[model samples]
Target: MADLEAKPPLSPSSTLEKQFEDFRHHLEESESLRERIRAVAREIESVTRLIYSCLLLVHQSRPIPEVLEKVKAQISKLKELFHRLAGILRECPGQYYRYHGDWRSETQTVVSLLGFMHWLETGNLLMHTQVEERLGLKTSEFGLDIEDYLIGICFMSNELPRYVVNQVTAGDYDCPRKVLKFLTDLHAAFRMLNLRNDLLRKKFDGMKYDLRRVEEVYYDVKIRGLTANGDSTRDLGIQGQS
Candidate 1:
């Protein structure tokens, strides 16, 4: 008698249709956004595999200066692709809101997605410190500044929790609508990240407390829990450069 509340997952066809419908509605606001989304989707379909491979390498490798170099190279490649994508969008018009609506907004969206992935990448590094230390390496000397890395992590971690907040609290029609579609796409990427390595989700969960702090700072949202510190970071045994 307890079988009345199950929900079904969205079929692939339904997902595409919903995305297109949202695009059409958003296009009514700016044709450029519609065009840019299509362009980026095409690029994503083509380059996602490469990005995944790089991400996997970053996640799975032991800490060494060379590995950090490789990670930096991968990040540079990601940024180059994003910039090229943005150049295509800029050929149309206006500043990409990265936070608001318009044709250029797609760059901001892509940046945020990349940022989240990067943040997780770093968090993984910190979480695995003992492994790196065992190899006689210091993760911090990868040669990145705190502000730059922190901002990227903050931006990336913000995406989902912010999406959650927008769904429940925001009154802005356009912003919420855009965020919903972006959130769906981000989750799809998250699923791909999970599939690439069965252990990622488990490892990710082990660092959830740290990630939550990132999400909080990114969205300027607060939670009622003590922030993880000291042995909290060490107990996880994740290597951190800082």
Candidate 2:
């Protein structure tokens, strides 16, 4: 009893317990953040596709007022999402937000894209100028004329691969692999959207040509078989077939 009493009671280390609790909290917060990131990433991808669809629709002379409206709405949502993400990030230690890491760069890229999209829709060149001022993007950086915003998509696609590969190899963070996948999916979405836009433009051009040819054929047949009263009566079978 004396020996036992001489020794102090054994208890878990409060420091270790607190450390473990902090670690668990960090893990939970990280997981929640990753989920939010994925949700926003998916939203960004879908909005990108919708924007591309609007571009193609407007290019094809389709009534795209609704699409344009939706693009604007989605862009607004993206801005809100960014704000939320930034808010969460601010809770983190200052290193991440201060460093020129992939997350920071990617967020800025989204801002530039949104700005340019507004410029395209509203014909407000000021939007593009402001984007350049805010993001330090240049017209030559995208390899396109001043009137074109699709060039920004190209710039984004070109830069994504390297950043994704780096994230995959760095292995310092959780969900690096998921981040890579999201970036890749974004690049793919942009490419597909661009291709679809080109195809739709071609299809519209072809349809216009076909309509013109049909009108030409109708006029030629009418001129060849017209009466004085501007009516055709010679070809009952052919006219009926047409």
Candidate 3:
């Protein structure tokens, strides 16, 4: 009996139990955070769809100003959602990438829409910093991924082909030439970057098709002798607004 008593009872190890308890609490907190992030991301995605629907009106030959007016409200909503995302990410202080995948698709979509909108509003490539500013995402903590920005730009490029086609159909003959010029310059600019991402590279390759489509449309317009003779600054481009 003394031997058993001296050996002590077979109680659980307080140290091990405390460590496991800490781990469980950590996992619970992490799950809660992820759920919050996902909620904000879902809202972001919803707003993106709303903005995209408004942008489609442009393809339907709707007036640019009218489409923009509808999009403006959604932009305000996206800013709020992104702000909420940034706030939630601050909970961990230094783990932005840990949860980045949660909103990756939504953010990419947002950037694409914003890039297209910026092009319509200003006729310039939407810079990364500009996107950050537009979304109110400029925090010292963490922010938009560069790959997401590049991918979004590629997505924006995909829209130009369709826009140019519709523009010519709408009797805006010079639209093709201006789009061709813009795409040429944009493609040249992309060539300067040493992009290593497979997805981004694939998307960039697709821009060539966009450029080709625009080129074909421009040549068709040129052959038909229907090109506009204005100073080339009245459509799709906001002078001095970039």
Candidate closest to the true structure, highest TM-score: 3
Instruction: Pick the winner on lDDT between candidates 2 and 3.
Output: 3
What is the TM-score (0 to 1) of candidate 3? Answer: 0.86
Q: Give the true-structure RMSD of model 3.
A: 5.8
**Residue pairs with backbone atoms closer than 3 Å in model 1 (clashes):** 116-156, 126-238, 126-239, 127-238, 128-238, 128-239, 129-238, 129-239, 140-241
Report the lDDT tens digits of candidate 2 across residue range 1-242. 88976957546797678889999998898777766665665665566666555544433333436556666666665556545555555565443323223243344345445544554355332334655444333333221123233334334333223332333344322222222333333333343444445633343344333333433433443464431243332321122211
For lDDT, the strongest prediction is 3
Candidate 3 clashing pairs, residues 3+ apart or interchain: none
Candidate 3 lDDT over residue span 88-204, tens digit each: 888788899899999998999999999999898888899999999998887576678999998999999999999999999999987887777788778877889998989999999
What's the TM-score of each model vs. the native? 0.30, 0.37, 0.86
Each prediction's total of clashing residue pairs, residues at least 3 apart in sequence or on different chains, is 9, 0, 0
Per-residue lDDT of candidate 1, residues 1-242 (tens digit): 34556667799999999999999877675666555656655554445445444544433333334444554444444445445545554644543334122212333233334554534445222212332232232333221222333233324444444433443343322322233334333333344443343343443343343344333432332232222222133332323311
* Off by more than 4 A, model 1: 1-33, 44-49, 58-61, 74-76, 95-208, 211-242
60 in model 2: Cα distance from truth in Å? 1.7
Worst 10 residues of 3 by lDDT: 233-242
Greater-TM-score candidate between 1 and 3: 3
User: Which regions in candidate 3 have their CA more than 4 angstroms from the true location?
Assistant: 1-21, 228-242
Per the 3 Å backbone cut-off, how many clashing residue pairs does candidate 3 have?
0
